[model samples]
Target: MSGPADDEGSPPPAGYVPAEGRGGFSTLNGPYFHRPGEGELAEQAFFARRRHANGLGLVHGGMLSAFMDGVLAGAVFRGTGKTGVTIHLSIDFLHMARVGEWVMGEARLTRATRDVAFAEGRAYVGGHDVVRCSGIFKLMSRER
Candidate 1:
């Protein structure tokens, strides 16, 4: 978990807002609860075929990272109104995932306090975990 650290006051995201009335800090409620949009998250549909394999028919590794990134970012958006910076991320490929597979990613908050948050998530296919991620997000302040 290492990346270029951001100085204070970096913008989080367009709709970035603090997790209002959500305690001093917040955590993920599981995968299905943080749908910020229309079909993909709520409809429980698989959204990426472009990330699929080229030869042996497995999902690409970059695809794995992208999936993890999106899942964590979504969690950050839910836990805190604004978006969070992915300061640190570690992904472990547990197994191969193929195209046309319905998978879900969930962030399990290990800790969230102050301006930093620690969380973990697993990508599951058919109730089996295919990837695991541990992330450290730099929470940005929301203007009141």
Candidate 2:
């Protein structure tokens, strides 16, 4: 039942889906979900009080890494219409994100082979850059 404060007034950003019930990690770092659009995929998470923060009162780097993974992986899925697993992930922390802020992550598929796809993205707080990431994902066999 943990989520963004009820008092917050902004509606969910355009194209965002509720991340609830997606699974454990999503629930922990989330109520996070994606907004897939024409050129890229955007994933969003609202930073709750303690769950996403480190001792210094900034949003933890690990949290941003997870968010990047979700968004970049999602970009691969949406781009190829295939499910994928991360084979590799890299992130660069650029700025600090504060609690009670909405963090936005956007990613786009870079290239793909028959089995692997590559992608890169960034996470932002309002207009401030927070983290940038790239990932390689192995496309799973199509389920039938």
Candidate 3:
């Protein structure tokens, strides 16, 4: 069977647009994309380039963790209209995603209090699970 790396030049699935204003560490790691979903939800995607792969030719765990962090943080922002820093993050790796695959992630705000927000997210390639994560974020004012 042809592995994901064989489809290197394929375009991203429809309705995805380049995610803008992703500065700093994200800028170095991405050119990420997003598709707006039902209220306060968005799906994020990235094409796993060779830079994202580890020595074994699979997407690195650190890359998947960082992607999940962004996904959960985005859920917090959209669901609460506020921003926050990650206080705690937990991730589970289920399957390996190879380079050149289109990995997509979705997250939702599970609960939020004045001080903190909780969210869960998963990353996948096609129908296969890659990583699942949950996070706690310390809520912050937009003015900060």
RMSD of candidate 3 to the truth, in angstroms, is: 3.5
User: Per-residue alpha-carbon lDDT of model 2 for 49-124, expressed as tens digits?
Assistant: 5567787768888888887888887788778878789999999899999777778888889998889999999998
lDDT by candidate, in order shown? 0.56, 0.77, 0.87
Candidate closest to the true structure, highest lDDT: 3
Candidate 3 lDDT, tens digit per residue, 1-144? Answer: 355554544677798888888778997888688887666665899999878889887999999999889999989988888896999999999999998888999999999999899999999998999999999999898832
Cα deviation of 80, candidate 3, in Å: 0.1
| Model 2 residue 100 distance off true place after TM-score fit, in angstroms | 0.9
RMSD of each: 13.0, 3.2, 3.5
Stretches of candidate 1 off by over 4 Å are 1-51
Q: lDDT order of candidates, best first?
A: 3, 2, 1
lDDT of 1 by residue, 1-144 (tens): 222221222333343233223322222211122334522231111322422444565767776676676677666655555556789999998987775454556665566677886767778777678888888888788622
Tell me how many clashing residue pairs each candidate has.
3, 0, 0
Residue 34, candidate 1: Cα error in Å is: 6.6
TM-score against truth, every candidate: 0.62, 0.83, 0.90
Residue-level error in angstroms, candidate 2, position 111: 0.4
lDDT of candidate 1 at residue 116, scale 0 to 100: 81
- What value does the lDDT take at residue 123 in candidate 3? 97
Residue 111 lDDT, candidate 1, scale 0-100 = 66
